[model samples]
Every structure is written in C-alpha cells, then in structure tokens.
Target: MPPAHAVTWRNGFKSAFWIANVLELFERFAFYGSKAVLAVYLANTIGLGAQTAGSLAGLYSGLIFSLPIIAGTFVDRYGFRRTLMACFAMFSLGYFLIGLGGMSAGQGLVQALGKTGYITSVLVLTAIGGSLIKPCIVGTVAKTSHPDVKALGYSIYYTLVNFGGAVGPILALQVREGLGIEYVLVMSSLVSLLLLLGTFLFFKEPEVEPIGGNPRTLGQVFRDMLLVFGNFRFISFLVIFSGFWIMFWQIFYSFPFYVTDVLQFPRFELMETIDAWTIILVGVPMTALVKKWRPITAMTLGFALASFSWLIVAGSPTVMAAIVGIALFAFGEATQAPRFYEYVAGLAPKDQVGTFMGFAFLPVAIGSFVGGPLGGWLVQHYLRDTMNPAMMWYIVAAVGFVSTALMLLYNKFFAPREAS
Candidate 1:
C-alpha cells in the first residue's frame, strides 16, 4: 500500500463505498427524523404521559444501540447485503406500523394490543432493524476503501451521519407542520422501503478477506462478550462515561416537553437540529484545535463545557439561550467524542483491540437505557409539579460536573500510567 498522503481520495474507493454511504445517509435520515418527534408524538398524539413516553422512547433507542453487539455476529454470519435487506424490510414494516398506530383508521390494532403495547412492540422491531445498519455500513466501508484512505473513508462516513442528523429534524419539523406528525413515521417508512429496493438493486457485497482468518461463531462472540465484561477497569470507564450520553440524550428525551409544555414552542423539532449542525459546521476546526491534547484532557474539558452549557439555559430560559446552550454542548461533543475512540483503543489489550472497540458502544446503550426514564422524571417533577423547570437543567449539569470530576480522579489514580 502507498503512503496515505500520496493516495488520491477519488482512486482509493470502490463503487460499493459510495453506494453504502448513500444508503447509510438515508438510514440515518429515517432514524433521526422519526426520533425527533417520537417523544412529542407519544405524549400529544398517542396520549401517553410524559414519563411513559420518555420510557418508551428510551427503550427503543436503547435497543437500537445495544442490539448491535449481538447483531454484528449475524451480519458476519450472513453477508452485509443480505443483512441490510432484512434490516430495511423490518424498518419499513415497523415504522409503518408505528405511524399507523397514531391514526384513527389504525385504531383496531392499537386497541387490540393497547396503545403502549402496540408502539412498544413495533419500536422493538424497528430497533432490531436499526441495529443491523451500523456494522454493515461500517464493514462495507472497511472492505471497499483502500488501506491508505481508510481514515478518510471513515471521516466521510462520519460526515454523512452528522449531515443526516442535522437535516432529519428539519424534515420532521416540516412534516409535522405540513402533513401531521403521524406522517413523519410514514415518511421514514417510505424512505426505508426505497432503501430496501436500493440495497437489492445497487448494493453488492464487498469482497474482502475475513478478519482473524474466518468469521467467529455465535459462541465465540458470546465468549468475547464475557472476556470484555471481566475487564473491571474498562467496564468502570464505560459506566462513568455513560453520564455524558445521559446528559446528551436530554435533547431528545426531555427538551420537547420543555419546549412545548413550558415555553409554548410548537417547533421544538427544529431546535433539535442545532446540535448536529454545530457538529457539522465546527467539527473540523474543533478537531484541529484539540487534536494535540491528551485524550483524557480533551475529554475532561469537553465534559466540563457540556456540563456548563445546561447552566446557560437554566440561568436564562429563552429560545436564544436554548440555541446557544445546544451549540455549546455540540462543541463539547465534537471535542471529546473522536478522542473517545482513540482512548478506548489505547486502553485495550493488543490482541483484544477489535473486541474492546466493539464493546465501546456500551456507554451509549447504558446512557440511553438510563437517561430516558431519568429525563422523563425530571420533566414530570421539576416542570410539572414543582413549577421550577430551571432546576432540571441544574441537575443535569451537576451530573456532567460529577462525571467530569470522576474522569479527573480516574486519570490521576486508576488510569494506566501511560494513558494518564
């Protein structure tokens, strides 16, 4: 392989690279677009209480991230193209059912299962579909890109992910306003159906050598899971880092209620775009600024910034304040998030790098599973009962502060000396 710098980006990729990325963009688009309105739809449209809505949303999001661990093994057993086909088929059906559950015409089924049960069942199915996407898309990128430009390939992938994140909410806002919120899920279903056809027509399985000689059996994957769980230091790190995601997920889990119920804003979905847009606009500059800092230092500073961002909104409850706070949070995320992977890889035992990297997603899963209920509780307690919504953000900020402090303590004492 040639030096990375000497390789031209155009020549370093195969046809599958572009196809996979395009598919991923729409997949993210469908996921985030529906997610942008999920909590609000549940509360206002489906008549669930705020806490119940948050719990359901969290369950769906949690399953999406957590299932990938097990789902990746299936992707390896099947091929990427086949797994993707199955994924989109489920996405289409699950999203359609969810949308259907919101309409009067769909009342028979909703009443049959109960609204909560109907939504939860479909959401679990949708999450399972979503779980297959990441590994397939990422694996395709790895197989399709030349070794020299693999970094650039992943960078392109990351950019599209954020692009989808940034735009999905905008689309949701429009659909919610113009067509109705139920149509947003229908929109996602339509997109998934298109992706299913695209996968069938355009996406070819990339030819690449299997890692570690052959694909691991499901038994081996489970054994690897056990090995990863046995590493106390790593598990502790993942648990502590989950605080960041718990804080981060508030944008989806709690912010809608805050905007609509408290601030009387009808367009909270648009506000959801700020975080992704901030990352898209400033990611490069932020990466450049923090690239030279130690991973722990960058992460600590990032956590502090994210923590402090909430206080900005807490002190002054206004639309502008909310925007500024979300932007600041995104800056903090961009600063630390890339370095997080670097830190994890560095902490892994040499032979177990792949295994450790795979499990690196655990913090996100933990955060979503825990954060949803927590966010809902905060909304119900602080906003609904106490009539002091600002206190909610203060508590969120405090979590971040504590997490940052813990990271500092870990760096000083428990982290490997070289890592410190």
Candidate 2:
C-alpha cells in the first residue's frame, strides 16, 4: 500500500507538484503582467506608430509562445531543475532590460536609436527570454505528475495560469498608473527570482519509466525533434492547429485593444470580471464536463462560438454586450483548452511524449508571431474608424470560421485513431 498520505514537502511527490504549480503562477504573472499593458505602453510610452507598436508587441508576444522548441531541447538535456534555474536567471535579465528600456524609450534626447528602432530591439530581447520560460515550466510540471493524475494536473496548471493572467493585469494597472509600466517589468523579474529559488531548492525528478529507445540527452532532443518531424501526418496536424491558435490567440491579442479602443472597459475591470468568476469557478466545472467531450469537437465548437461572439461585440458595443461576448469567449475557452493537450498526449507514440508536447505548443508561438501585425493592421485600419467596426469583427470572425472548418475536417477526415 502507498505510504500514509502526507501533505508535507517531505512527501517528495506532493512537494514537487505544488512547487511546480506555484512557480507556474509566478511565471504567468510575469507574462500576463507584460501582456496587460504591452500594446498601450508601446504606442504611448515608446512612441511607435499604432501599426508599428501593435506589430512589435504581437511579435514579442508570439515569441513567448513560439521559442519553446529550441529551449525545450536544451532543457531536456540538462534536466528540468537546471533548465528552470537557467530560465529564471535569463528571464530576470530580460525583464530588467525591458524595464530599463521602457524607462528610456520615449524620453527626449534619446533618439540616437531612432526611438522606434530602439524600443523594438528591446521588445525583441524581452521576447527571447519570455519564450524560454514556457515549455520549461510546463515540462517540469509534466515530469512531476504520475500518469493517472497527469490529466488533472495540467488542468489545474492551466487554471492557475489563467488565474495569474486575471490578476497580473489588475496589479499592473495600479503600478502602471501610479509609478509606470517600467515597474511591471521589474515586478516580473522579482517574482521570477522567487520561482528560481523555489526550483533550485525543492524540485526533484519524478520516477518515470525509461523510454524503449535510449533517451536523447540535450543535444539529442534537438536532433530527435527534426527526425521526428519526418512524419508527414504529425507536421500536417501541427500546421493545421497553428491556424486554430491564430484564432484562439485573438482573445489576448485583439480583445484588449477592442475593449479599450471601442468597447472601453473601466480601468482593470475587464480582467477582474474574468478572474473573479470564470477562472475561479467555471474553470474546474467546465473542464470536468469537457473531459467526456471529444477534443476536436470542442475545438470546433469553441472556434465557431468565439467567432460569433466577436460579431456580437462588434455589432452591439454596449457594456452588457461586451460582458456577454467576453463571457461566451471565456466559457468556450474553458470547454476547449483541457482537451487540446489531451488530444496531443493521446496521439503521441508514448516513447516520445515530451517531444510531442513540446511540438504542440509551437502554434501558440506562431499565431502570436503572426497575429500581432495582422491584428494591429485590422484594428488600426478597420476598427478605429467606428464606421468600419463590423469589418473588424468580420475579419476576426473569418479567422475563427476557417479554424472551425479545419476542425471539422480533422474530425471527419484527418483525426488520429484511438489507442487500444
């Protein structure tokens, strides 16, 4: 029988999982804190043109999602603990640079870097560090959980991520309003320091079975990622799902711009509504329900509903309408998210599960990478005019429509087979 249950870190497994969860919260706080104010800060403080700021912020944000493939391979070699410590250090360096840069960005007499050129460079550097943190923290979490509880663990993980997303911005608003956006970067660095310390002291590798083939060390994980992609079906799905994320990501990329520019949420109230209710209450319940729903099916429904909700907000523009639209968006997100990973994990060839998980996150990176410029253009050219507002919705709706069509195709024609 299992040893009597202990709630202490001395219990090893519980310590590892909870510590991972706590670190996940801090990392997300950093990410969402930056995200909460990035676009506005870029345009107002950094003095990039509307188009330039949006494009750069989008690209930087996407990098946070995209750069994991390279980082994951590097970390897999050194082991999760070492990789995490390294990431935290790098993250602190990057955020501090961003804080220093944001402070200097638009001030008079600093035009030597041509204002725009200088700020853009800093954002890109920030992206480099942000990109490394994601897969490493997640991979660490995956390493800690037992197979039977892995699904529950990730669900909890994503929920905490959203919780942080919900809270980080509200905190950002206070700091941004009182001191400045520069402080947001500094704050993220501080939290990252705590997580770095947490990992160095407490994180321990899980007792997992060895792979059938000799496991690739760090150098090998990179070589293996390239080799594994030789499978046509896997690449095809990854490409298709990239499109899905392109649509999914707009909740972050476009919603803030839309709400503030057109719908106009009162201060940080937008994040508060979602954090207070949806993440805290709806997350677990919706996840439990979706456990029985087919992931592809949920993806299809989420895309379709969120697309229509864009139309609803665009067309109505009332406070209640915005609330309704965002609520639908959040609820749909809840239904679809847990399954996204389940489908990936279920499809993996067991021996290379970590590689596949790393691969699956690539689309979030790609979508953000592209969505920045595209969403910026759409907002600037279409939505800002007020008369052309629906066109903005039309474009966003089209993106989701395409994803919905693709999900249907996958469900009907391209889906992977279930294991025996």
Candidate 3:
C-alpha cells in the first residue's frame, strides 16, 4: 500500500515534472548564457586573446565539475528543497555580479572594499559558484522521483536538460548579438529569478526521503564514496569512458576558435550555434529510435558517431559543413547520456543505489578537467598549423573511436554484467 502523499505525487508527476522542465529551461539559459558568449566576451570585451580566453573558460568549466563532489553532500544534508532554494538564489547573485560589467563592478568594489586588483578574480569565482547549481539540482530531481517511474522521470529530466542546453544558448546568442554580452548576463539573471520563484512555490521534497542504512554522518558519506574505488569495475568504466568526453568537448572548447581563425566562416559563431539547434530538432527523434539498444552498446555507438562528426569539418571546410559536424556530435551526446546512467543505476551495489549513483558523475568531472586544456592546446598548436588545422579535430575523433572500442572491450571482459 502506498502512502497517501506518494499517491498524490504520482497522480501529479506530469504536472510536477512540467514545472521542473520550465525551471530547467531557465537554469540552462543562465548556464549557456555565459558559455554562448564566454569566449567572445573574453577576447573582444575583456581583452584576453583567444587561447587565454579558452583557457580561462576551461578553468571555469573544470571548477563546475570539481566543486560538486563536496557540494552534493551539503545539498543532501541541508535537504534537497532547501539546497535547491539556495542554489537558485545563489545563482542569481552570481549572474548579477558577472553581468554588472568589469568596469562597473570594479568601481563599486574599489569604493567599498578599497581594491580593484581582485575584481577579475572575484568574477571568476562567482562564475564557479554558478557552475555548481546544475548537478546539485539534477541530483535532487533524481533523489525525489520514485523507483518504478524513476526511469521515466529522469528521461523527462534529461530531456529538459538537453532542452535547456539548446534553448539557453540560442536565446543568449541572440541577445548577445542584439544588445551585448551584458544583456545576456541580465537575461540570465532574470531567468534565474524565474527558477528561484518556481522552485520556492512549486517544488517539494520527494515523498520518500533518501533511505539508506541508518542515516549517514557527513564523514560516513565521504567514507562510502571512498569505498566505491574498491569496486574495480566501476572505477575502470569511469577511467575508460573519459576519452569520449576528451573528444566530445572539443566542439565547445575548440570549434569556435577554429571557425573564426582558420575556416573563415562568415559568422564564426555560427559553427558553435549549430550545436544547440541540432539538439533541439533531432534529440528526441534519435533518442526514440535508439531506445531499444543496449546501454553499453549505445555508448559505443555514441562515441563512434562523435569521432566521425569531426570529419565533416575536415572534409569540406565550410560553415555548413561545420553545422553537419555539430549535428554529428549532438547525436553522440544524445545516445551517451541515457545509456550511461542506465548502466550506472542497474549496476549499483545490491543495497547502495544512492551512494553508487553519486559516483556516476565521476567520469564527467574528470573528463571536463582533462578535456578543456587538451582541446585548447590542440587548437592552439596543431590546428593553428595550416596543413594540420583540421587534423586537430581528427585527433579528437580518434579519441572517441578508440574510447568506443575500449568500452566494448571493458564490457566483454571486466564489466559487472555478461554481454548480451
């Protein structure tokens, strides 16, 4: 027999998830708002050169992943609802500080704190704080949904994530072109406000609390995560899967600069622009067709497709060709997400679902940290050389294809389950 509250929540899951989707839209808008213009704003607006800008942006990205290992615990302890409320509110503050402009923020800070030397550093830190919101919220959503429908629930959530991924960037790009980077900042802040309001009003704690062996102390959670390493299979997967991101992330980290510097695309941004557009148009249909595929098999296909996507840019060397490249990359991402998590949830230790689940993001954070600098360096060196500019992408593609092979091999010999 279900609890009365669980029954009520089940009845309204659709409506409940719709609100989550809307909030996700705004959350993504805030996130990609920064990304859409981050490189351009750094080079053109902040006076950093392309490589410096990419490195700085990469640093921000790396922190987003790094901070969450600890932040997730704080969120879990404080209660998902409280943690979520604070996340949106904190996110709004961070976006405001970013968009207030370097000069404006500098002048205000110098007047109040009697220092301007630290303004850029402070702004960078603020961006890092903003970066922490996504994982925490998504993690919360997962914690809140029920076991049976949880699969459907997360699919809805993941769709919202991709939906936001595409929607936010495009919206921010248009605003950045029309008004300025500052406008995107302002727009992101407003969207943050919408998220805050919606979460405060509509979001609730899951009817079922996160149940585990007697509630864990803060130290115990850390100890449990450390225990994950004892299971070689999970750690091996996280290690091998990192190569996929090493390739996939280049579309964001390196592709923009490549379009502007080498290919001579009419609008350099258009190459990057195609990513969100393709995901919006094609994510659902592709996901539907591939739903029946095995998880690791889908992952293998995902990485292989990603590796292949890069060749489009190499083959034709046109803006339209680059859009085709991004579409290919999006196909890789769409396949990778669902299958990866399904593998994680299904393979969790007998009684450690939530604990095992938290470690699932291990590969992502690792990938971002490694991939960012790798992409930046590859673009600056190999890609900058005329004979090899497109070859940099080939290296990225190779990484993906190699990873796909390695993942299949891991499944065959080392993974928990026998091959289908």
Candidate 4:
C-alpha cells in the first residue's frame, strides 16, 4: 500500500516537483521582468534605433530557446543542483551588469565598453543562463510527477509561469516608475540571488531512470539533431506552426513601439501585464470548455481569435482597445498552447522521443529570429515613416490568418487522427 497521503496541493506529486515549480516562478520573474521593458529600454534609454533594438532582442530570445540541446547534455552530465546554481549565478551577473552599465554611463563604466557593446554582452549572458533553466526545471517536473498526476503537474507549472509573467511586469513598472530603469535590472538580480540560495539549500536531485544507451556525447546529440531534421513532414509542420509565433512575438517586439510611438500611450507596459492576468483569471474555465475539441480545430480557432485581437487596436487608438486585445490574446493562448504540446509529443516515434522533444523548441527559435527584425522593419517603415501606423497590425493579422489556414491544410493532409 502507498504511504498515508500527505495533506498537499496534489496527492502523488513529490516535494521536488513543488520545489522545481517555485524555482521556475523565480526564474520567470527575473526573465519576464527584464523582457517586459527591454525593447523600450534599448530604444529610449540606450538611444538605439527601433530596428536595432528589436533585432538585438530577437537574437537574444531566439538563442535562449534554441541552445537547450547543448545545455541539456551538460545538465545530464553535471547534475541538476549544480546546473541550477550556475544558471542563477549567471542571471544575477547579467542583470547586475546591465543595471550597473545603465546607471554608470556618464561615469564612463558603461561607455568604456561602448553603449551597444555593453547591452549586447548583457543579453548574451542572460541567454546562456535562460537556455539552461528551461530544460532543468521542466526536466525536474517530468521526473518527479507520478504518472497519474503528470498532466496536472504540468498544468500547475504552466499556471505558475504565467503568474510570474504577470507579477514580474507589475513589479517592473513600480520599480521603473518609482525608482528608476536601472533599479529594474537590480530587482531581477535580487530575485536571482534568492533562487541561487534556494538551489543550494533545497534542490535535491530527484531519482529517475537512466537512458537505454550510453550517456549522450556531443557527437551523439548532433547526430540525433540531424536525424530530426531529416524527417520532412515533421519539419514542415513545425515551420508552419512557427508562423503563429512570428505574429505572437510582436507583443514584445512591436507592441511597445506601437503604443508609445504611434498611439501616444504612456502605459504600454499595462498591455503586457494584461495577458498574464487574463490567463490567471480564466485559463481554467477556458481549458475546460475546449477540452473535448480536436487539437487542430482548437489551434485554428486560437489563431483566428489572436489574429482578430490586433483589429481592436488597429481600429481604435485607445489604451482600452489594446488591453482588450491582450486579454483576447490570452484566451487564444489558453485554447491552443496545451493541445499544441500534446500534438507534438504524440508525433514522436518511440526511439526518437528525446530527439523530437528537443527539436520542439526549433519553431520558437525560428519565429523569434524571423519575427524580431520583421516587426522592427514594419514599425519603422509603415508606422514611423508613413501615416498608416495601423498597417503593421494588418500585416501581423495576415501572418496569423495564413498560419491558421496552413494548420488546417496540414490537419487534412498530414496530421494523424484518432480515426486513422
């Protein structure tokens, strides 16, 4: 018989899962806190052009999603506790450097390195740190949850992540407005310090089964990656899905510019915070309503809803429209994201499960890499140079509409169905 059930959030989940979840919260806190304000900081404070700022932010975000193949191998070898500690330390160092650099430019510290040089270096450091954290925390969740409660565990984990995304920007707004932009980075560094301490004291590596083959060498990892690339159907589907993200990522790359530069709104960060809040409030109900829907159908609707969200902003130049758009976007995210992951995991052949899972991030990386400069260029040419600022949203909506159509076509032709 199982040991007497402990009074806890969930009966079967191990303490390690909760610990990993808490750590994920802090990790996201630092990350989103920095991200929510980064585009504006680059353009306004660093005095970089919008195109330059968006491109830099895109490169950083793309690498963070893409570099986990290498990082996961290191984590497998080095163990989770050490890897988590290193990641937190790197976050602290990166955020601290950005804060110090921004605060000390006139004093010649930041200027000594060149303004762009210092900022880019900070981003590179954070990307390396961010890349490592995703695999470690999600891997922990996968290891610690009992099979019966595994889905619930991930649901809770995602909810906490969205919660952190919500809280991070609110805290950033307060720090940036009440304190200063420099203090916002300092705040992120402080959160990283807490995570480092937590990792050292409480992060006991959970027990998990070993892989069937020999430990993954770098050569083996590369070979596995190439194998994934050789699967044409899978690669094509992922590329098609990447179009959604190409549009979605504009929240980070384009929304702030659209609000502040075009709409003349002072509270652009409010739009960022709204999506997270909507996720927190209605995610459960929305998920329940769509639980029986086909994954492809749900995803197509998600794209449609999210695509239409931009129309609210395009038609009206009010902050309220932007807020409503973000809320709608959040509901759309709730409809599609969970099902999307399930679909991807189901597609993997048994021997290639690990390989396929790692490649799952490829679409995200591709989207950011493509989206960043594209968003910047759109804002620069259509919004700043011309009278039709709203044309940017139309372009973003077009991407989403095309992606939704592609998903439907893939479903008809390629997707494996329950009836199949």
Q: State which candidate has the highest lDDT.
A: 1
Model 1, TM vs. native: 0.97
Q: Name the runs in model 3 displaced over 4 angstroms.
A: 1-10, 14-17, 100-124, 131-136, 139-150, 197-216, 230-232, 266-270, 280-285, 344-354, 382-388, 417-420
The order by descending lDDT is 1, 4, 2, 3
Q: What residue runs in model 1 are displaced by over 4 Å at the alpha carbon?
A: 1-6, 210-213
* Residues 163-210 of candidate 4: C-alpha lDDT, one tens digit per residue: 898888878888899988778888999999999999999989988797
* Worst 10-residue lDDT window, candidate 2: 6-15
Return whichever of 2 and 3 wins on TM-score.
Answer: 2
TM-scores for candidates 1 onward, in order: 0.97, 0.83, 0.81, 0.92
Runs in model 4 deviating more than 4 A are 1-11, 105-113, 209-212, 346-351, 416-420
Model 3 poorest 10 in a row by lDDT = 113-122
* Cα lDDT for residue 339, candidate 2: 81
**Error of model 2, residue 12, in angstroms:** 7.0
Backbone clashes under 3 angstroms, per model: 0, 2, 0, 0
Clash pairs for candidate 1? none
Return the candidate ranking by TM-score, descending. 1, 4, 2, 3
Residue-wise lDDT of candidate 3 within 1-420, one digit each (tens)? 877666344563544455656677678767876676666665556555556656666666666765676666666567666766676777677666656643465456645643323334644565555555665556656655556677667777766666666666677768877987767777777777778888889977654454666544668767976888787877778878888766656766777777767776534444565666777677778778779998887888888887898877788777777878888888887777667878877666768877777777777666766776776677667655444777787777777778888888888877777332
What C-alpha lDDT does candidate 3 achieve relative to the native structure? 0.68
Clashing pairs in 3: none
Candidate 1 lDDT over 115-194, as tens digits, reads 88888999999999999999899999999999889999999999999999998998888888999999999999999999
